[model samples]
Target chain A: MTHQDVVAQLIKLVEPYAEGRVAHITANTGLTGELALDSLKVMDLITDVEDHYEISVPLNTLADIKTVGDLASLIQKHVGNDA
Target chain B: MKENPRLLAVRAVRQELATLGIDPFGIQIDEILSPTEGLIQGRRTILAGTNNYLGLTFDPDCIAAARDALESAGTGTTGSRMANGSYAAHRELELDLARFYGKRDAIVFSTGYQANLGMISALAGPGDTVMIDADSHASIYDGCNLSGANTIRFRHNDPNDLAKRMGRLGAEASHALIVVEGVYSMLGDRAPLREFVEVKKAFGATLLVDEAHSMGVLGEKGRGLCEEMGVLGDIDYVVGTFSKSLGNTGGFCVGDSDEMEVLRYASRPYVFTASLPPATIAATRTALRKLAAADDLRLRIRENAARLHAGLAALGFRLGAPANAVVAVLAGEKVEALRFWHHLLKQGVYVNVMVPPATPGNESLLRCSVSAAHTPEQVDAICAAFASWPGARV
Candidate 1:
């Protein structure tokens, strides 16, 4: 999948946990700051994304993820590597 | 002016508690009257959060053993086991624990936290991977951090997630160490040990089960989940604490692996910390023997847990898990949980208050632990206290 496709799917996966802050979510949205997602919520989001994409997102790879755009990029990279 | 990050966090938490008009942490129990009752805030309170599963804390034999040891061994062990602290009692307890679990070797640590810290850090190192449950206790997380291993967390209690993660690692999966708990303390749920064993065998990875909550609470012989699930021989390491069922203070790791003995020399947590006092060691030894034969206590605790769990659920409370000794009542918001905890305390009952980040799913929990020693009347009182909560039935 393309990066934009990854971002769109990511937004949908995280929206429910966003707690009515869905409108604030975008490619540039910060998972912690903008969405106010705690570590546990972030982990749930990561798990959902992994299951949806059928790809592995190692915890170490999540260290560099600060924004939705970064997460999308990471997912895309993993998908590409998987393919 | 710059402020310490830790202090800032503490201030924020304190402000929230102050607004809620409750202080649930570090509560002072002026007197422990029995295994199930205590004097808290000048009131006779039922202690439903002590995690004294077998209720042997005040057993006459245990008390006598502790006293005799205190008189003979004096007050403290001033040195670490690696130094002058490996007293005869410590070694004897280790041997007894090894035999109790039917394992070839066992190593004792001063506290349960150190058991996980020492075992995980010593078992997995650089170039290795540590796969743990997302809801694992903090000690396990700390151990992973100290291991210098690439750590990954699978969805809690989901063996499929663990299998998939292990598959993704390919060759490195062989070097992975999968860790899980026998009975999770917060939610009182159990891991799918049988399924996990299959995954571990498939991936050629080692499995470590922390039975801190299950020891003396499960299995015919009280050897924990491994024995209860008929997977004792398959588990690579079984770690547990004496603070819970044994009602003493210490931790141990027992296994059949020859490498287990090397941890005595390698684990810093074990080598550096002072050994448990002679009195504690003596008491734990007695407790262990008693626990092995007290199948009736196990049955009584489960019965008490069922009574309490059903009572709370009937009163319109959402439970985190099923009927277990550790019955966690789900309270949606932190403030709501604090209110419930305070209400229970005022009604002469006490339970643990678990809040965000510490509790999984960002949920708040009023964690109630049942003990074998609690009378049926005490259980009824505990239930009635919850039933009496304001708008509880509504």
Candidate 2:
């Protein structure tokens, strides 16, 4: 998957759980400060992503997942497509 | 003083609860006389929220043992275990725990939290790695933090993910400690210990099983999940608590050989903190003996839990995980959860109102822990309360 594709999928996955404002979470949006996805929601989102993609996402990689763009990049590295 | 983030967060939490028409800090139960009863709002409330797994808190033997120690040893240790805290009872409980688990050594901590904090931090340091279940208790997470280890969380109860993560760790995997709970506190689901043992062995990672919620509730002799799974010899460390099943207040870590003994000298949580009170140690020793013979109590608690879970599931309430002792009623949103909690409380059933940050999946939950002392009528009352809740039909 390309970065754009992964970003799109993550955005779609996170839209329902994001409390209103993050419905339009862009690829460059910061997860905590920008999109307002707190730690619990982020963990829930990570679980969903793992289930959907059938991949294991390490908790240590959370440092790189600060932004939606960073998440997309990581997903691309794992799932082999950005989207 | 300028507004502080922590204080602001607390205020925000209060405001948020008020917005939802619920009090976040409501319902303080001042004095709990028995494991099954509490005084709340100047009224007697059924104590279903406590994890008194075996209901041995008020046992005559336990009480007498604690009393005897109180008379003999005075009050608190007044010093760390490394100093003046190593009483005869402390060493006795440690030896008794090691013998009970068939391990070479056991190290007891003042509290269950400290056991995890000390053991995990002592074993896994800055260069070492600690792989944990996503659903692991907060103590495990905090322990990892104190260790400054490279911490990674795998999916809950997913050995495949654990193995995959282990496979990815080229060299560090060998030294990693794969931590999991024998029985998860929230969902009351047992870890697939056999699968974990297999993957842990294949990856050459050490296994540490926290039996806090399972020590007296799982195995025949109440030795915990390791004994139940017949893999007691395989797990590197078995960490457990006297607070829940044992009906006392302390924690312990037992392991084969002298490795755990080293934790006594090395663990900062152990070395720096005051030891378990003499009365607590004495009561726990007595409780351990009772737990070993309290097969009937274990069976009753299990049966009660099963009945409650089945009844709640039948009532159409959304339940989390396959219930064992802990039955979690899933409330999707926080408001409905707080509302439902008040409804249950009004019905005279006291349960844990676990909200976000504490609950997994960002879910809100009403968690009930069944005890051997809870009569069938009480369980039925709990079930009936849920069954009668508006739109709560299964």
Candidate 3:
């Protein structure tokens, strides 16, 4: 799957907790702002994402990942199968 | 599949720091002098960020006790308590702590962190649950994690939220250990002990209050929130540390003799970790003894905290919680927080800089922890430094 496809999947996962359009989760969309989720909630989301993709996103990677696109690229780069 | 998100996260943290024009982690203090003063960047600074609440670290009585212990007991235990490490001083300290709290028993640990870790983990296991406040210290979270129990958090200082979560536990709720702090670390707000006690009683759940920051800072004679709130006997467990107000390093769990005594043998963290050193036990004993009658010091400390809070508030800086020993200034973003911290350091005042991951909702904070040793002038100096900073208000 492409980076966009991965972003779409992750966006869907967080959509239930988010506002407006999931597609608006751009490369610069702050996860905390877009989803109105706290740190622990984001941690829970990351756990779900890790389980779904079978890829490990380190704590450092989380610091770098602000938007959906950045998250997708991280998964792609690490797991080599982003979606 | 081979990549490690953990290492990547560290690198990402470095990258993020670069982008934000700050350092995620930097600087090292050669020595921390006092709660109101320390040496940073080769300059003497007013230390307003340390959790040295009672200012007993440099007390003559405490220092003499520690010195005597060092001469008598050496530097370390160098072995777990279950091994050959439980010294006479350790047992005496435990007994003293129990008597001080008016509890039947008290179990001591190497550090405050391990006290929660050992007590919470041992009391509640995989099948049980640990309910904590969202604003609890990291040690509490670590304890819950170590327990292998299902952990849940209630909203900060909200008894209703705690009740709602307890209701979900159903019959298994009795096994849940509801934990909270007397004075929260970040915001410096006291827990609603009476309401929380009522809620815990209603649910038939056990309770544990970490008085790490409140031990000698509240209550008549400094017994902490339980005594001050008049719910001391009703609560199941009272856990606290000597590091903060007591001005030493160690942790203890005090409660009814029958149940708390069992933890001495059952808790892995307590049994496995080397016993606290003689010096710590000795100094802590002196501190605890003085604590039971140190109303004057507690009053002065409270006055100092209030003075700082009122001063900061007057300057239009958004203070955290109420006028308490801890005064947190909101900084919104990491870059701005770093800049504010740097500015404080340059002004010869040292405060803690907390940002995302560590802080709730990734909100950056400049936290100032007050102590009894802080004079009115020092408090005024700190406030003046903060007011002088243009970047701090935002």
Scored by TM-score, the top model is 1
Candidate 3 chain B least-lDDT 10 residues: B21-30
| Model 3 TM-score on a 0 to 1 scale | 0.84
Ranking by DockQ: 1, 2, 3
| Candidate 2 lDDT tens digits, B63-99 | 9999999999988899998887588878999999988
| Clash list (residue pairs), candidate 1 | none
- lDDT for every model? 0.90, 0.85, 0.82
Error of 1 at B58 (Å): 1.2
lDDT of 3 by residue, B329-349 (tens): 888887788888888888988
The residue-level lDDT of candidate 1 at B389 comes to 78
lDDT of 2 by residue, A12-33 (tens): 8878767688546788778887
* Candidate ranking (TM-score, best to worst): 1, 2, 3
Candidate scoring better on lDDT of 1 and 2: 1
Candidate 1: tens digits of C-alpha lDDT, residues B1-394:
8978759767988888888779999589999999999999999999998989999999999999999999999888998988875889999999999999999999999999999999999998866889999999999988987887777889999999899889888888888999999999999999999999999999899999999999988899988888999999999999999999999898999999988778777898998898899899999999999999999999999899999999888878888888988999887788878888999999999999999889998778889999999988998899998887784432
Residue A1, candidate 3: C-alpha displacement in angstroms: 29
Per-residue error for B359 in candidate 2, Å, reads: 1.5
Cα error of candidate 2 at position B159, Å: 0.6
